[model samples]
Target: MNYFELHIGDYAEATQHLSILEDGVYSRLLRKYYASEKPLPADVAIVQRLIVAKSKEERAAVEAVLQEFFVLAEDGWHQLRCDGEIERYRSGEPERKAKKANEEERMKRHREERAELFTKLTAAGAHAPWNLPIKELRERVAALPAIVSGDEPATPATGPETLQVGEPATAPATPATATQTPIPNTHYPDTNTQTPTNIGINTPLPPKGGRKRSREPVEEPQGFVRFWAAWPASKRKESRGKCAEVWVREGFEALADVIVAHVEAKRDQTDWAHDGGQYVEAPMVYLNSRKWEGAEVGAMHQRKREVVI
Candidate 1:
């Protein structure tokens, strides 16, 4: 199952041991003779020539000479094996098993450390009050003044009147001035104006239709909204590790998208109006670490929230 076993024991020695040794010897002898000031023996001269020779036949002849040494030297042959099988076994099953066990223990320790840290963190910081109802959370958030409202109270402006006689007299009229004729409600002939001759004081106004209704104001609940942007709840939970800092930005994106889309499509306007305010806490966005922020919400680009707050 291991590399050495697959290649048969002492595979390197059986296959290329002689050549490998010769290459080493040849290289060393060449370095000592050619690179250094030392002069090689005349017989050793043959090695340098054979190594430099370009022909394959010449290289084979040189290798044959090296093999002769390997055959005669029992110590040399044993040296080539050199605890090969034992070394391979030591590197195999037992070592690998030990290493794997050590790795698992390391991972287990790391997990325990994280869990302990989380326990400490949960103890230190606030826990979302257990099993809080959605209705209650909403109510609490609703009580907050910062929550956006659906409609703003309209403030009437003082502007010019269209020739209506509704101004209070700035100065008292002179008592002896010529009697002024009272102005009557005159009828404009054209347009959608219907002149009513029966202009009695207590005439009820026409049924209150045919006018464009004003848009409702936006309202926000009292508290900040919690939106989970992450796909799985586990990711959200994990990010809250110990003194968890990072929450997924995806959750906030989801909340913002939903709220924005709802508003843009004008859906649930009545419900929103009933709900007190129109604002929803955008999805939970843990930007980098340590803090969660709300996503930017608006009509057109709300759907494309990858990471905006």
Candidate 2:
């Protein structure tokens, strides 16, 4: 849902009559729609807040686009095109995984072929010294056929040494990878007397003060995103990480649609509105306490939850 292609000609055709401002609003709405992979809210005011609509004209345009392009259902405002794209992306997960596997296999074969060629040159006392520029060596090896077919590789003479060429050497232990080519681990003298140990490639030394490693970004759940959008964005919206954790930990994915709808509906209630949401619980509190279920909520929370689940 993070990415979806837009056919420029098709989009232009559909929105040709829309004003510049209206087109912009439509695009933003699509972004929010795909990002969460959820329907737009039936509530126009909530949609305006989600899309950051500030101007009177912009707010009006939100209504126009939703009316023209989106259909309001019991769940929310659903766009046929957006739903189709999201469904297709999710359904193609297996194909994407297969493509990644094929790419990795290609890289592996490339490494093995280079290793075989390297071993051949080493055994023949060829001029492919460890000190040769890696780029040049790689280029020369690349020009050669993958397996040399039904013939032996021709030995090229270097000097009076008359060393054999193209004779396969002992099997290479393993090869350097594209990401990290195996480089010589051992030091070699100018005479090239010692054989270099083909091991890990040379990695760059750390900077003077050292560098801080960065952590990977986390992908929030779609339901959590919708719930978060509905949650008031005051200082009370803390511990977002914990809230996301609890979201899945409590098996809320099944109830996410219900929870988000309930939370949005309750946003205007007396308990939440008192003291400017001072009593409006943090997301974690709201989720853990099951505040969305009103009085006598325990029985109703379970019964309704069972139906949704």
Model 1 Cα lDDT, one tens digit per residue, 157-266: 44454335976545544775457543452322222343465333444444444333233332322111222222223223332322112222222222332333333333
In terms of lDDT, model 1 sits at: 0.36
Using TM-score, give the best candidate's number.
2
Q: Where is model 2 poorest over a 10-residue stretch in terms of lDDT?
A: 300-309
RMSD of 1: 26.3
Q: Estimate each model's TM-score.
A: 0.22, 0.40
Model 1 residue 241 CA deviation (Å) reads 20
List per-candidate RMSD values in Å. Answer: 26.3, 26.7
Q: What is the lDDT of residue 106 in candidate 1?
A: 69
Per-candidate local distance difference test: 0.36, 0.69
Deviating ranges (above 4 Å) for candidate 1: 1-21, 25-58, 65-80, 83-92, 126-309
